[model samples]
Target: MRQALLLALAALVIVSCGRRGPQPQAVEPQAFADTTPPSIIYPAFGDADPHPWEDRHPGHYPVHGLDVSRWQPPIDWRTARASGVSFAFIKATEGGDFADPKFDEHRRGAQAAGVPWGAYHYYYFCRPAHEQARWFIQNVPKGADLPHVLDMEWTPHSKTCRIRPDGRTVRAEAQKFLDILERHYGRRPIVYTTVDFYGDTDIGRLPKTEFWLRSVAGHPRNVYPRAIWRFWQYTGTGLVPGVQGKVDINTFNGTPEAWAHWKAGG
Candidate 1:
């Protein structure tokens, strides 16, 4: 597939300030024509809409949300919520080393804003799944709204890239981490990866896991073979009102009730 090809070629590989310095520039990702189906197009939800809000506001989208690590600025969560952010994912830790300093405050602030939250750990292929799982279990706090994520990708520019593991090894380790996270959090963890990364890894093997897919052009199914995406991030540099800068835009799958069921595991 195109994604698989990109992943093989990628050998390849976010933002902001105050807490920790930004990582080095990432390699330019290989672009692919989006071929996802229209039935899977993520529509706006509830009273808060992402399209018109962003269009009318010029740079702001309502219900817009973002993820951050030490390299990114400390977001004004309250402002973000007031402006209409419904959810967020914070970087908690990476591999078996390096924890984001802003995670604690971001977690608290987002909760205070009444936003549903999730946490992500940058995957290091060189690390053992058990080791990384243990690290995540040790650091992230348990909470009602928190879901865990596995950030899998090929980071060619990474200082730690030399030891990047193969896709099968990557899937094995990720599954281990996901299993541990599910045990601690009492919910099936989400898998976050670019289309290319997903195709490169054995993601299809973990069919039970919900996916948080990154597809800039269209829905995941059109772009991927038998894609089962629960979340679709359509844009990364999306301009939204109320927020200070560009924010990532995503669509949750299913209807309102479906969203509720997914959220409550009902």
Candidate 2:
């Protein structure tokens, strides 16, 4: 009887201790976040070469465009065209599993509106190169109006990829993905990355690929650690006419002739 009672008491003690589960390491429930304003650099293109960029009338540019995800809805392409929007780059997919719901709608809408458009894939540094490339290719259609862009940046708040490979590994993975995309798309995909991410990963080594540099404050020269940039994303909170909330803005790097030749050559 005594031994049974002792065993029962021991089992009870063990059960109670097991329920605690490492005391949860006393983690002080990390503080939460609220709506925060994104960092703003150069708010306007007042200092850029106005002559090279064609203005809608005289002082405005003719090719201002927006890049959007599913979160941005009910795009009024007519109003956007009137407001000088000439192109768009819509989100298509990411990694090898997730796809942006906005891709089909944006593609169809833009085609119907007679606007040039492109597709972008959000890159996951941890994912296999071939898999990620396949994800993009499988989702986005062939003969797309504009070029495909590999959006490579540190998405610190990404629910899936809060962590990434080191810089050297990251670049290697990027190269592998790019090679696959180029083989399939028949043109080298554009590399879209912020200055910090570019600096961290020696992006200059990938010279064959064009870059859609994201530098909100200064020119790609001043901001990007590298020397050359083909496209520039200057704004993410732009208040265009058709876009109800904020939207991204981009600029092409070359003349109309150059654009035509490049497309033809590709």
Q: Compare the candidates by lDDT and give the number of the best one.
A: 2
Tens digits of per-residue lDDT for model 2, 63-172? 35678889888788877776667678899998789999878998888878877888999988767889999888989988787778899988898877766567888878
- Mind sharing the TM-score for model 1? 0.72
TM-scores for all candidates? Answer: 0.72, 0.74
* Model 2 global lDDT (CA atoms, 0 to 1): 0.70
Candidate 2 runs further than 4 Å off: 1-62, 263-266
Best by TM-score: 2
Clashes of each: 16, 2
Query: Candidate 1, 250: how far from true, in Å?
Result: 1.8
Task: Give one digit per residue, the lDDT tens place, for model 1 in 1-266.
Answer: 99998876654331223247667533212112222333342323232233433211212122335666665466677766666566788889987887889888888888888878888898877778888888887888888474678888778788755565677787777788888888878987888888777777767567467777887655565666566666667666654444445556665654445455656764
What does the lDDT read for residue 231 in candidate 2? 67
